[model samples]
Target: MVDRLFRMKTKSIFVRLPLLFIFFDAVRCDYFPTLYPRESETREIKELNGLWNFRADMSVNRSQGFEEKWFMSRLEKTGPVIPMPVPSSYNDVTQDKSLRDFTGWVWYDKEFFCHYHGKDRGSYTGTVYWMITTNSEEAKVQVEVVDADSNTVVMGEGIKGQASVSNVKLWWPYSMVKTGAAYMYVLKVTVKDSTSASTDIYRQPFGFRTVNKTNTQLLINNKPFYCHGVAKHEDYDLRGKGLDMVSVAKDFNILKWLGVNCFRTSHYPYAEEIMDQADQQGIVVIDESPAIGLLQQVYNLTKALDPTRLVTFASSNSNPLSDHVMNIVDVVMVNIYFGWYQDTGYLQTIPYQVPPTLEGLYKHYNKPVMVSEYGAETLTGLHTSPSFTFSEEYQKDLLIQYHQEYDKLRHEYLAGEMIWNFADFLIDQKTNWAYGCNKGLFTRHRQPKMAAFTVRERYQKMINETQKYQN
Candidate 1:
């Protein structure tokens, strides 16, 4: 069977699919592609984002779809099909319970025509580093830095060389400083192969800034930085982690309104479109990998690839004293739910439970620490006077308790604090979950709960303090 599978002739298979799955075998490189897609004078990108034919392999062995070569024909012709939106988790889109709970091989395919479109440019100043990969190592590569406003070349006209920009506008997080701004510049790369008579051009947008950490603080542009932010998931009503621009715009607006300057992409990286907004708006991102284990390898490879940024993992381990990976991280990020998960119903225990753990980690490693995830589940509209678990007041008080502890050590070794969730998100049905994890400051539909107001007030105060310090 293995021999027969290997002997099968390779054939072209074109179908509507998410851009994330599209792979080009022609281009190869050592580093992972972290660049966001952009249209340029020589390059174009067409979004294949819409409804696609979908099917779940329900056969006895769950190999029927692959064995029948379903990719060669329309999915509907092979079996009963459903219209599933691209860039979304198919689990929660349908009303059927089986589909919502399905865990198996699923297929999605779409067909469309390609067209050309024009591109626009933006302006900024900064030191930008770029990398390119070509099929042939001998291909001539040229890079240019273009001033978007004047349409003039600012720097770079070489095959391989470094270009420096003096008096560069450094990118800063929102309200990180009194005069902070998210400035960006355009980089144009061109590749030509004389033998193949082929030419390709691509443009990338990047910013210049410095990020480093001391024993006590995280610094941006040589100034102390604090993350008055929340950990967010790429999830929404009906979409289930799908890329939705409307939701993205609304979320950014809310982030600004709540005075949030930084956010950790909890559990995994977010959509490239969302990242572009973060770059343009000067939002600090703690990018995270999808995998949970093998911290040493992940940390080393990430640092090697992008040494400019700090690398750390969100550890759920309560006992940090025994964490072997603590020394490997740039920042010690711990997700302790002392009040909520451990000593349940004892909100007062937070102050007592949190300090020792944080202090121990800092004393052992002498590295900056952050409360990467901490929150209590609270159902919206559920209220109680004195506050108890699963009530709105309890969630609000839990965050308040955590903040109070964080404030005590913020000036010493505490670097930042991020609440577990920015908004409510869906999860597999469990007895403990109230519909889903109700730990979000905002409800799933982006509606604010009582905890939202509490967080916003604290974050706004932090922003004011940051501005005052900058002055």
Candidate 2:
């Protein structure tokens, strides 16, 4: 059976499809590529991705004081419980979608004291680090920083304040060159009870890499590199969209096989392992903040916070109606995201989000920005085909207009924009006018919806024509 499968895949019709399947299959799940030299660094990483014990409380106010140096001293012995994962969120893995939907206060506690030792029996100087994420603090309170940065936190309050760490190894991404299979890293998170009679603690295995965007371009160690890549969503087979670690691994392997050097996670940030693999393979990545624009209808107070300036993220080959639709939508997306900027009084006053969003992203792990996903889908061009959208006489005039607007902003401000999607995807929802049109540069099933070659040609020209090196 295996021999027959190999023969079929070897045929031209099967072509890259079989390799694609294998690549994605391997990267998506926890498995090896059968043969290849291993990296010692890869084995060094201890992945802490799994079900973590959890508890959620909406009424109890979590301590914001944890932000201070004197925060980690608190500890509690009992609570109503559930399951969560380190490097994960309550928004995922919840059986009751309703509980997952509402973001209040979520508390997770896991007991893991590192089994792997560096040197001494129990005297080695180590640290406990955490990646703390909170839903929305407006309704509740939580801490959101990797716990290692919060070492030796002293308690200012009772045991109500708590943080967690798990024992795990560093993760591997398809970073650069011959990345060793083993990772040279460690992570620790410990909360001490100076006020209590005992040493109350929680620990985890972890490591850190600094990501910062610099100059006019993005860089990891100190070099500029463009993203050769694609965007990814969490859907395949039957596991659905939950943050399954095995699935993420399979997907990573797929990208590696495609010779993809970079990827922008559409809509929201992806699993921690995704980034870890990027680190291993030197794959450039844009870990975006979660998508909140679509939540417009979910919240009543959204429109009032149209704080960021939407300077028209138009396309170069945009059509008119599409332009108008995009002009309106960019304003909405800006409103939702920049609302935080406005609330903090940092909108136009500082080139903060624009420069630093790129810079900050590149700073930790150097990689160029795709600005990856942006723009909207136009319903006006449903009749037009893909290649013809930019054929000089396309029915869709608005598509070009959007790119034109987007191009004007290019320079040091943004690197490259993959522009939302190459095609539409299935969401099983009525939100996309019977299809998720807003996401497609092309349509579902790989059809060149009305914005295909138009985008590709223009972007290619921009790359070919511009001597960006002169700057």
Candidate 3:
């Protein structure tokens, strides 16, 4: 499998998908991929992902687990046991449908071997970090790092926090530093046993990396990074939004193939595992919240969890609300569908429409602006005379115009331009929808469309031009 995966290059960027499934399959553990080290601390990250001892209190009326301190692992033998897979939804794992829907407190238990070696054992330095997620306001979650004697090493409240300790390790991505091996630590997430607590403890394994921004560019570990990828959606047949490792690995491989360096989680945040994989591959992700009905609180939370990246809402239209929201964000982004959805489908219209939108944003906000999305839906193999909607030639030509206009503006005010999607994906079947939206550079199964080559060539040229000017 390792030999089957090869490398592709475009100018200076070396693109390769390091297939780690060979080791992942053997160990049955998933690595949580957040770069959490603040440079002052070295941390050890362990993904408690495989089979965990699970007990679901379906009674919908019990609360004794919290009062009795069930999170301490002392009550391991107090309930019926079933081996549950970590990093998976507990809904479809059982034969009983009620168990799938049973929303009470589900207890998960796992023990991992931790090694601490220091001559001065009293001053060991380490920290335990994990992400705690919940859907209900009434839900209560707690985490504890315990020793063999059930002594609490550290404890915390809320969904995601870090508990500092002594004598630990640091995680590095394969792309960042190839150490030939990866190390991790263990974490336990628990909740109160009650009808109100419909809880699932997910396994998160993150490493140490820092994200921050400059006036004109994004900085990873203090180095400026230019995003050159597409807006991606979590849509696939059969699985829908369910976590499928195969599709994810394929997506990473395709992103590498494009020679692009980054992508935004379009519309919403992606699965934790996907973020982990992105971390492992060193792919920069512009994590987004929901499109509409979204609150500033959501962006606040995302920024709080990952402070290295900026949070900007994708504004489609110019309005007071959007203008007000953009004022509050770290960056300004707009999703314009002009020349396809609004204006005439003419290339000349693009130059007129795009520049003013960006210039207006720059004038008012004085923040870096990016074209988050801009594309026309084009069906594969379809052609048209003047480049009409749903035609491959139209999609190709429309992108060509948009890119040309963006090139002229990017140097001045625009920071990046992410095409609507990398691939055509599953969508709700409706009257106006043609099978699925064909606005992708590739088909749903990862087949390249005409626009794919167009994008690749344009990206390569852009990189070469930037390099020449920089030199």
lDDT of 3 at 74: 29
lDDT of 1 by residue, 277-357 (tens): 798778899887865677777877887888866888888874665677778888988898988889999988888888998
Write the residue-wise lDDT of candidate 3 on 285-304 in tens digits.
78876646565787777768
Order of candidates by lDDT, top first?
1, 3, 2
In terms of lDDT, the best-performing candidate is 1
Root-mean-square deviation of each candidate, in angstroms? 15.0, 20.9, 17.8
Error of 3 at 304 (Å): 4.5
Q: What is the Cα-based lDDT of residue 401 in candidate 2?
A: 45
- After superposing candidate 1 on the true structure, give the runs of residues whose Cα lies further than 4 Å from its correct spot: 1-126, 147-153, 157-159, 193-198
TM-score of each: 0.72, 0.35, 0.58
Candidate 2 per-residue lDDT, tens place, 194-286, comes to 343222233333333223344345443233433434555644445545666544543543344334455666556677756655654455665
True-structure lDDT of candidate 1: 0.76
Task: Score each candidate by Cα lDDT.
Answer: 0.76, 0.38, 0.63
Q: Is candidate 1 or candidate 2 better by TM-score?
A: 1
